[model samples]
Target: MNKLSGHHHISMLTKNGKRNNDFYTKILGLRRVKKTVNQDSPSMYHLFYGDLTGAAGTELTFFEMPVAGRTVRGTNAITRIGLLVPSYASLQYWKERFQQEEVKHSDITTYAGRDALFFEDHEGLRMVLLNHHGHEVPAHWQSWDGNEIPEEHRILGMGTVEITVRYLQRTVNLLKNLFGYTVVTESEKEAVLQSIAGEVFGEIVVKELEGPSEKPGRGSIHHLALRVASVEDLQEWDAKIKEQGFDSTGVVDRYYFQSLYFRDRNGILFEMATDGPGFTVDSAVEDLGKKLDLPPFLEEKRAEIEAILEPLE
Candidate 1:
């Protein structure tokens, strides 16, 4: 009965690395924890943004693929990503800021028993901010001097994410058997699952479609990662995922952590990632996101790789 702690992060495809960096880091006030290239494709950038420490649950990563098409908002894809704010006061601050910035948003809604504010990023990626009542905000994330957003107001982590699927039972089963989640509640249109460790919650909703099924596109979720306790637990789950007949890529080193990825029945990519040796592994706590870092394996190619990446600011 190995269960995931909760979400590690969600990866999204962005149009420009620098622009995405500015929005998440500058406007959204997340810390740019890492600046590196995708291991599979060195020509593209893989940027990570999160709390100051880049802790397990508080991260959102991106694959810079400027030429990709906009994500179509229907059927068999992640619909929205929700981030946890510290309190109701913080939510009010964000509401005012969003209005001041002229960002389109919806009125606060009560979903799954939490107060939530929904909005979109520059690329139209739907996001929600919620007041997470029971969770403690990690000490290292109390203030981010970078975005001038105080630590008291930083994002707690992902609250819940929506996955719209056509085949509901299969997707629900995979989440339970493979990821160690328990069904908390369900409606005719949606099912909500709580993680084993209960650090965060998630939703898998069913959306009926009329014609052909849609493919995962840009601005759509690239993958959702489930946090494992350690590398050993990750390997154990790797075998389990294979036994369940899902083809998973065996452990791949992500510098900050290790990960194994496979697509779910509906083609949404899912990753099981370890929770250790975080961003502080290569850099000091005070120096994270201050400069680009190359993993030992990529160090030799740094000069060439840096040349291909468009400068951020």
Candidate 2:
């Protein structure tokens, strides 16, 4: 009965690596923590963006699939992503910045009794800026003076993940029974779940929608990963998943962190990953995201991989 922590990271799809790189690192102000290839598919790029060191719960990642078409939005998908800012005033700062940069965004409004502003990335990726005003959650933000925005108003970390499912209760049950989340709020159409850690990052919004399954492509979220304390916790969770009649990828040695993956009843991919041996394993902290990084298993094929992939910079 190992309880899962909050969000580790949310991985999405992007069509243009260079544009994705610019939008996140340059426009959004999140540091490009890692530049690497997708382990399962070396032909594609896997880019990670986060706070100074790409802490566990702060990552917002992308997999570049140049040929990927537009995402066909529908049910049973991770719909909207929420990014946390230091305070309610940060929303105003971002709103003004978005206007200046011509970033598509909505007027500041309240969602679930919190001040929030909605915006879209270059690829129509839906995002919301939520206030972390009174959450007691310390944001893992360290600033470099060169960013377009100031240090106090920097985008902190991932706040919440919203998932839309055809069968709501099944997904809700998985969150409660398997993941050990407590439902904090609920209505006819949605429910908000909080993890044991009880912070802004631990919140999840589950919405019930009746529609066709999502046809994923560019801007579509691929999976949502939750944090596990250690490899021992992951192994225990792996057994629990199988015992309950769910198929899992077991323990995978992702060079940075070990991961176990399984889909929910709604087909939303959920991953349990450990926090150790992070982005600095192969590259120095200062040199991270500066060059192409490959794990030892893929080192031999680096030349072949590099030749096929265009320069992401």
Candidate 3:
């Protein structure tokens, strides 16, 4: 059976689109690669942030919902999102930069034998930056104002995503048996799963939660997306999910890619998406995210969408 290579992108909920865009672009120094609306709700913007080209593993996207209430943390929710920096010096640089910018962050600390800095976004979304040891990913974007961050200290891509669950075995089994992940490390409170070949993107950390189930709202993860090699692999996984007695979206084309959505044992949403027809499909590399680009099906309703969405900065 074909298995997921790694994470494609992580989609989270945010209260405002412009604030979300500024935080990722100006504050974090990431590139805003796509400006589109949520597929289900054409009124709300779905903003995508990533490396220079918005590579698969580097993407962090959000669905804007201004009126959504704050999320209540509990069991079975993604607790933190990790971004990879190049070195220990990079971590120190970030610490100093956060202090200078007044971004809420913790002092540098060690986790899993690497230096890290924990911080929260303007909307109180938990995040961490870890040392990635200089893994080369496509390209990275410079600051919009031309005051560029040094290449070495810039974010590499997505790191380990942390999730809280009531029980780990069910989730563990699904990851291993269905998703083709192998447990690389485990402890009483946490277990880390990665691809058998040891690629970085699908590295997931599951922590046992002692509290009640989580409530979804602003600042909660809408879904975690994993990558499949092709559309054929996606179709196979869709059938596999149904055969395993889980309800799945089957196959839905998202213009840039094909996708299938399902909930894991703990009720956290999981998306399996193909890794092709990327963001560049709709917009030029230099001009991506400059204007809203709708899928062909939604093209007819472009005026309606523009009317509904507030201009993102």
- Note each model's CA RMSD in angstroms: 2.2, 1.5, 2.1
Candidate with top lDDT is 2
Tens-digit lDDT track for model 3 on 128-190?
998876655433323233226777788778878888899887777788888878888888878
Model 2 lDDT tens row, 1-313 = 5577678999999999999999998889988889999999999999999877788888999999989999999999999989888788899999999999899999999765578999999998999999888455544445445467787788878888899999999899999887789998888889999886466687899999997999999989999999887999899999999998999999999999999999999999998899878998998878878899999999999999999988966
TM-score of each: 0.92, 0.96, 0.95
**What is the Cα-based lDDT of residue 284 in candidate 2?**
84
Model 1, stretches more than 4 Å misplaced?
137-143, 197-212
lDDT per prediction? 0.77, 0.88, 0.84
Candidate 2 lDDT at 101 equals 85
**Model 1 RMSD vs true structure:** 2.2
TM-score of 2: 0.96
Error of 3 at 277 (Å): 0.6
The alpha-carbon lDDT assigned to residue 90 of candidate 2 equals 94
How many backbone collisions does model 2 have? 0
lDDT of 1 by residue, 182-270 (tens): 78776666677777434454343333333345554566678888778788888888898899898989999987899999988887788
TM-score (C-alpha) between model 1 and the true structure: 0.92
- Which portions of model 3 show Cα errors greater than 4 Å? 136-147
- Residue pairs in steric clash, candidate 2? none
